[model samples]
Every structure is written in structure tokens, then in C-alpha cells.
Target: MKQKLIVEGHNDILVISHLLMAKNLRITGYNTKERYEKEFVSIGTGKSNNDGGKENALKAFKAALKTEELDRIGLVVDADSETANPAIDTWRSIRNILQQNGYQNLPAEPNPSGTIIAETDKALIGVWIMPNNDSEGYLEHFFEGLINPNDEFLEEARRITEGFVSDERNRFSPTHQQKAKIRTWLAWQDDPESPMGLALRDYPRLGYMSLDTPLVESFYDWLQLCFDTYVE
Candidate 1:
């Protein structure tokens, strides 16, 4: 069985792609708009926000159903809100879109493993929220979890970032604090130009953050279960 993964943006693709590589998974290549063989796992972005990206994801999911090679399809999208206490709103919005496209009986809530998956009539459909399965944040929040517990930089960055956000001159949306925090940490990297995904992949050498966390492992496992099959 060949697998397909649908993500929100380029950064999401970068993160998952690198995570797969870190686990020594031999991915053939990534395709943007074109459809490829099932032997290769192709990842496509749904744009930046939930609306457009989710729409794009539904399209990809439909396309996969038509192909005999695709046996599993996974979705990786951010919760992208201010609070996750009731992650229902965003979850419902995404769920409804998929329901229209053929996915059946998705969970009403996010899974603790950070994934909501179902064995649908079409294929195995999996949904994973960024940073965690039960969070109201984005990739930055996940990056925060991956930061080294001993890194004093994390504390210092938070301190300054909090102060900056409090300033009346600062106009970043309250929900975007995670982005501020992540960029703050990224600035200290040797190659600040490096994308967040690459920075994560090089965490060991960077010495500022460590990806050796339970959350990262959980996410890795989810990816493997969704796509790393050798079925014919």
C-alpha cells in the first residue's frame, strides 16, 4: 500500500519530511501538484491557514481515492487558535470538509496521541494537530516542546518576548506569540536563514534544542504507521 500525506504549508512539509528522514525512512521525493506513484510518499501544502489548506487537503484526499496505488492518506494541520481547551471549533470545521469528501466517522475530538485516525471505506485517514494532538497552537508550539529543557535561552527569550508583546507598539496577534517565541530562538542559530524544519533536523549540532522528546517520538511513530508500508 502506498501512502500520501497532506500538510498545511511549506514549513509543515519541511518538518514532517525531515522527521521522516531522521528516522532513516527512504522517501522517494516530494511532489507539489502532480500525482506520483504509491511507492513514493508525496506531500502537498494546503496553503497557510486552515480554510484554504483544508480545502486543498480535501482535494488531495479525493484525488488519492481515485488512484489504485494510494492505500492510506494522512492530514497534518495546525490547531491554529488561542485556546485548545475546546479544540472543537477548528476540529469541526476541518472534519466537516473531510466528511463531504468521503471520510467517515472521524472522532469528535483530537486524539491524545496528537492524531485522530479512522479506517475509512476509502483508506486509513489520520489527522494530527501541530505541537500536539490537543493544543491551540501552531508548529511553533511543537518547536517549543522540542527545545532543550536545559536551554537558558528559552527562558531568556520568553522573558524578552513577553516584554515586547506587552509594549503597545507591538501589534502581533495574541495567538501569534508562538511564532514570536520560535523566531526568537531561531535567530540565535548559526544559520538564521535556515528554515525552522532544517533547524530542527540540526538540533543536535546547534546545541540549543533537542528533538529527543516523547512528543517528537510520538509524531514519528504516527507518520510511520500511516505511510511506511511495503505492500504491493
Candidate 2:
């Protein structure tokens, strides 16, 4: 049987899609068909008014259930830029949407099949990958103690992100740049005591680790957990 996976994410998928392309990974309708015979579906919805973060995530999640054949889901969300802790409201909205649609009892913890990737105060998933400085190039003041301004990882990340975005200027905005940063971060957040927790507590405005890093290994772990918990 083919393995199935569902990722409820935001625009960060755009970068991930690009990263997969760089690795020669063929993503067919969200799933990396050539490698795992598995299906990867992303739900991009959220608040429609403000960049549609919430609306896009809901749309993706809803669409996945209806359009794809998946056994487990990984829901990724931001902590509202570490402003006021919007996780509860964001989660409630998501749950209401799901329950209203027909899900029975949603699990509390991030079940393997259904997980919630959240950061403290970062822009959704900015701190997870590269520091906020790399994206905004101006948030350097906020990154003190959290990350070294001249870290080598930032340069590596920049090289990897070349050609991912068309307009270089967009990489500085709180919305677009932050989203891309988070995508890169998610690709690399599994190391022991990953900076995710510390970043959150220290720099709330910069946001915490949502998934902007290249957390492929972490994602794999999450995928397996979801598969085990929900599939079989």
C-alpha cells in the first residue's frame, strides 16, 4: 500500500516545493511520487484579509481531505509573530472548521497523523530555519543572544535559496520574507535542543521556530509519527 501524508501549512510550501525541486524530487500533486510512492498534500489557509494566513491553511486542509488519499496529517501554524499568542484562537478556528465539517474528537497533543507546528512569537515559522536577520536584513537588533549575526548557516541558507523568489525586495517584508525564512527553518529543526525553544522565549517579535529551516529530517520523523499514529 502507498504511504500517505498531509501537511497543513502556509505559503512556506512554496519554498519547500522549490527545495524539493533542487533535490530532483518529483512532487506530483503534493506527493513525492518518484521516491516514496507516497502522497504529500498541503493545506494553505488562514486569515484571508491579512495575507490570508488562516484562510489559506483552512483551504489547504479542507481541500486535502476532499482531494487526496491520505492516512495522516501534519498541521503547521504560526504563533502570530509572537505578538499576543494567537495559537489558541488559530487552533480554535481550525478545530471548529474541522468539527463543523465532521471530525470526531481531535487529539490534544500533536498526534502523529495530526500535528500542530507552532512557534512562540516569530512570524509563523521564521526562526526555525535562518535567523530573522537573514530575511528582513534589518531585524539584527532583535537577534542578539538568539543567534550569531555572522553565522555561517545564514550564508549557506542564502545560497540554497537563490532563484526561489523572483523579487529580492520581497525577502525583507515581515510577511513574504518571513514565510520563506520559516520554510527554510522547518527543513532543519530536529537537532537536540534545536534553537526553536530558545528563540521563542528570547525574541518574541522575531517569532519562534515554526518550520522555516530545512528540517527534512524532522519532517521525516513527523511523517513517520503521523503514519504510525493514524495509518497503522
The parts of candidate 2 lying over 4 Å away from their true place are: 1-11, 14-39, 42-54, 66-69, 107-218, 228-232
Backbone collisions counted per model: 2, 47
Tens digits of per-residue lDDT for model 1 on 1-232?
Answer: 4567776666776676666556666433433223333334334435555434545655665566556466667777766564546346556766776676666778787776755455535666666777687757777888788788768877877877788778844568766776887787788777777778898678756676665789987887777666543211
How close to the true structure is residue 165 of candidate 2, measured as C-alpha lDDT? 53
Q: What TM value does model 2 have?
A: 0.40
Error of 2 at 176 (Å): 5.6
Give the least accurate 10-residue stretch of model 1, judged by summed lDDT: 30-39
Q: lDDT by residue for model 2 over 82-101, one digit each (tens)?
A: 43433444555556655554
RMSD (Cα, Å) of model 1 = 4.4
Please provide the root mean square deviation of candidate 2 (C-alpha atoms, Å). Answer: 12.8
